[model samples]
Target: MIVSNPKQKITAVIPIRRGSQRVKDKNLRPFGDTCLMELKIRTLMQVPEIDEIIVNTNSEDAIRIVNECYAVGGVKTYRREEYYASSECSGSEFFRNLGEVTDTDVFMYCPCTSPFVKPETISQCIRAYAERGENDCVSTVSQIKEFLWLDGKPLNYDPSNAPNSQDLPDMVALNFGVTVIGRQDLINNRNIIGKNPRFVVTSDIEAIDIDTPLDFYIAEQIYRKTVIEKLELLE
Candidate 1:
């Protein structure tokens, strides 16, 4: 078994909730052949660098699924407070809450939303994060070189003197496909990405995080592309 350093254990912390305003039971809803929760847990299990996997959730169904299929192979479920899982909460304490739950040396915030985040990508991120320690957090992001607009203004370029999109400064957006940080750093910062965060660039398809109904539908189509067109994995 490929393991983390004995001094610093890496645990995958997956937080899921049943009450998704955008899409009901998103974590447990039928996806491709398996649901998001099951798919994510399975994906994490493939990463040998991850020492442990914890499915933190407020849904009984999510807990049941984990206990049934994912309970083995260092994967288990942790019941979190329902209030913390609700939409009303500010979510500022998410990392701090995770810090309070477990004492693992390192925490990988692997959300189930990004179902397409490849296992190899996750393993690579974990390997890179092993060297970061408490100094830096490693996260997956997609480089956006396209023209961006904000509050009636060009965010990344001047419209009059626009350069080719390729020539524009690459703006990295946090897709949250995966985030690795030390427990202490998570507690100290109250966020997964601390002050000194290193980014691992992921492909556009792998960076898809299913949030809205349209996002869920699009992800399903992207996923089904495998069976429909016989495309290569995540191609």
Candidate 2:
């Protein structure tokens, strides 16, 4: 169980740029009834612990959508600078600027590509961050027990001595679905992952990140099959 602290001010940041090389207009593309960006905004609004939801995007379309539909609550849009909007720009460079954009105690970095990320997961991450005073950052990860290799070499296991799949060490891969970091850490470290970071393991469904056309199709199917159907049944 997670408890919310009213005193802690947390801001949710979603950075959506118009230039997508793989999937054209991926953020603005329709997921179900609404686009991916709108769905993320709506989902973020459900998390009560989040004090404000900031949509940092270079697209004018995104700004218009937020102003027209999601500006009612704690949601606000910020026009991203041209330099920060490019694909060649480093995350640290943009995040450094983000520290200047908002004045919240903590920043919840939520990517719009992760449409399946639940509000419960977001709340849990925030609560874990709050409870763990020693940790400067909390990030969502997917636990994998399967064989992993890099550069044609076994990474998680020894080739000479093979062990049972269950006996293999559980590896946690950063999902980047939800990350909680303090403003001071962002400015100091120039990265979301702080020195002392806590990992929150999430399910495979919740870890689904849409980056390509196939990914988008698969996520749409999952949403319609799982989330939308459940909501319809309740109604």
Candidate 3:
């Protein structure tokens, strides 16, 4: 049971570009009954704490779908510039441009790539951010207790002396499924992860990020096996 605070002006941003290199218009591709972009918008709408949901995209198909389905529920579609839509555009560039669009107390960067990111998880993250008096930002992350390596070097453990998986230091992988940051932080830092950022640890299923075709397939399977099956049982 999450309580909504009316005074907190929270805006959710979902960026979908027209072109996709790996998945080929993955945002508009059919997932279950609705497309990915629509699914994300629908999920965001369920969270009462979010005052506004903004979909920044240059895709006409995305705009049409939003107009047809989600135009009523505090969902606004912004016509993204061609420059920002390019694959060459950096994440910082997007955030910097996004600041000019809406003025809210908090900005939530919600990617449509993670289809399994539930409304409840989002609500909880928003609640955590609002309650965090001193913290500047809150981003969703997945806890990894397994061995980690980078450049053939053990990142989380020593090569010669390895500890048990449970005893090892729990590493957090940033999912980027949901990132909440203040307007000032976005303007100043030009990044989602602020100086004093709090982490919202999420389940592995909830952290499914779809980049390639294989990733999309795996995420879809996980969503069906975990989320949809759970929902069916509840009914």
TM-score of each: 0.91, 0.93, 0.90
Candidate 3 per-residue lDDT, tens place, 180-220, comes to 88877887887878988899998888888999999988877
Judged by whole-model lDDT over C-alpha atoms, candidate 3 comes out at: 0.84
Candidate 1 per-residue lDDT over residues 1-235, each given as its tens digit:
2335666788898889777788988888888777888888888888877788998888898888778777766588889887778766666676688888976988899998998898999988877776665547889999998888988888899889999989999799999999988889898888888898988999989999998989998998888785435644548
TM-score of 3: 0.90
TM-score: model 1 vs. ground truth: 0.91
Top model by TM-score, which number? 2
CA shift of 81, model 3, Å: 0.7
Q: After superposition, how far is residue 221 of candidate 3 from its true place, in Å?
A: 2.1
| For every candidate, C-alpha RMSD to the true structure in Å | 2.9, 2.1, 2.5
Residue 1 in candidate 2, Cα distance off native in Å: 15
Worst 10 residues of 1 by lDDT: 225-234
Best-to-worst ranking by TM-score: 2, 1, 3
